[model samples]
Target: MPLGSVRYERVIAASADDVWALIGRPERLHDWFPGITACSVEGNRREITLQSGLSLPEEITVLDDRLRRFQYRIDSPFFPYHRGTIDVIALSDTSCAVMYATDCDPRTMALVIGAAAAAGLDRLTEIFPTPIFPTPE
Candidate 1:
């Protein structure tokens, strides 16, 4: 079956290292990711509880510090295949771009996960507020 994919990017006024420090950790999803109420990670596996009380299992695929990329695959029985990737790209010393991408077999799952990903990016922006520049005299 062909997979459906979606990608969302947000430019945050924060260093890439700082951005990665928050979202890069698999065990910290509940702290920032919208809709996630709680998260428990053990070894390479993770279980997340949603605001709706639904729980889902996931597998941590990649956590590359140097590249600032975090990838995971949803291991829920309902979906045949689902993969999510979060990448932080450095735009400058004090700015970076966050990309959230999702791939799913059912196609519609992509839309669902994509929306949540969008909100998660928004939360990241809120957590790392844009820096204000001082006006020249």
Candidate 2:
């Protein structure tokens, strides 16, 4: 089956620079991403411990501070083809938007990942509240 993709976005009250500083760091993923109880990174490899105590391995494929974006791939036999990317776009000096995207084989995987992404964004809003007005076009 062809790969399926999902994208989720949330507006944050914090500045893009602030959000980037935190989210851009792969080691700090557990802070915002839901269900990630712990995270450890060595070089480009990362291991995340979920709430269920299951450890999932992932590889950091891209970390672009210039663009405030990062991409990672899950390493698991269960899902041979999986890739996730996160981008923080600056809507203003004190406001920004985060876009989380995932691509994986089997459409069902996209639904699961999309839920996780939505949950993560919901958690992030606690730190960065939703914008009152739409971000500038």
Candidate 3:
């Protein structure tokens, strides 16, 4: 089946290293990702609890500190095929860009996840509030 993908990016006034420090930890999803009430990881598997009290199981497929990126796959009935990645790209010494991308089956699934992803990006700004001037590319 052809996969559907969605991506969202945000520029934060912080170094890439700082951004990575916060997001690199798989267990910290609750801190920046909206609606995630809790996150726990065991080996490569993770469980995330939503505000609605729904728990979702996910597998940590990739954790690349060198590239400041990590990818995970959701194992849930709602999305039969789901894989998501978070990447932090350095834009400047004092700023960086965060990218969240997801691929799933039934193309329309991307839209459902994209809304939460957008809110997650918004939550990131709350953590790093110094918004730099030059727009992100």
Q: Can you give the TM-score per candidate against the true fold?
A: 0.91, 0.91, 0.91
- Give candidate 2's whole-model lDDT: 0.87
Highest-scoring model, lDDT: 3
Please give, for residues 1-137, the per-residue lDDT of candidate 1 as tens digits: 78889999888889999999988888899887888899999988999999999999999999899999999998977889889999999989898888999999788889888989888887887899764332121
- Locate the minimum summed-lDDT window of 10 residues in model 1: 128-137
Displacement of the residue 2 alpha carbon in candidate 2, Å: 2.1
Q: List pairs with backbone clashes in candidate 2.
A: none
Cα-based lDDT for every prediction: 0.87, 0.87, 0.88
Reference-based TM-score, model 3? 0.91
Which one wins by lDDT: 1 or 3?
A: 3
Q: List the candidates ranked by TM-score, beginning with the highest.
A: 1, 2, 3
**TM-score comparison, 1 vs 3, better candidate:** 1
**Model 3, span 21-113: residue lDDT tens:** 999999998998888899999999999998999899999999999999999999888788999999999998888999999999767878777
Q: List the residue pairs that clash in candidate 3.
A: none
Off by over 4 Å in 1: 131-137
lDDT of 3 at 80: 82
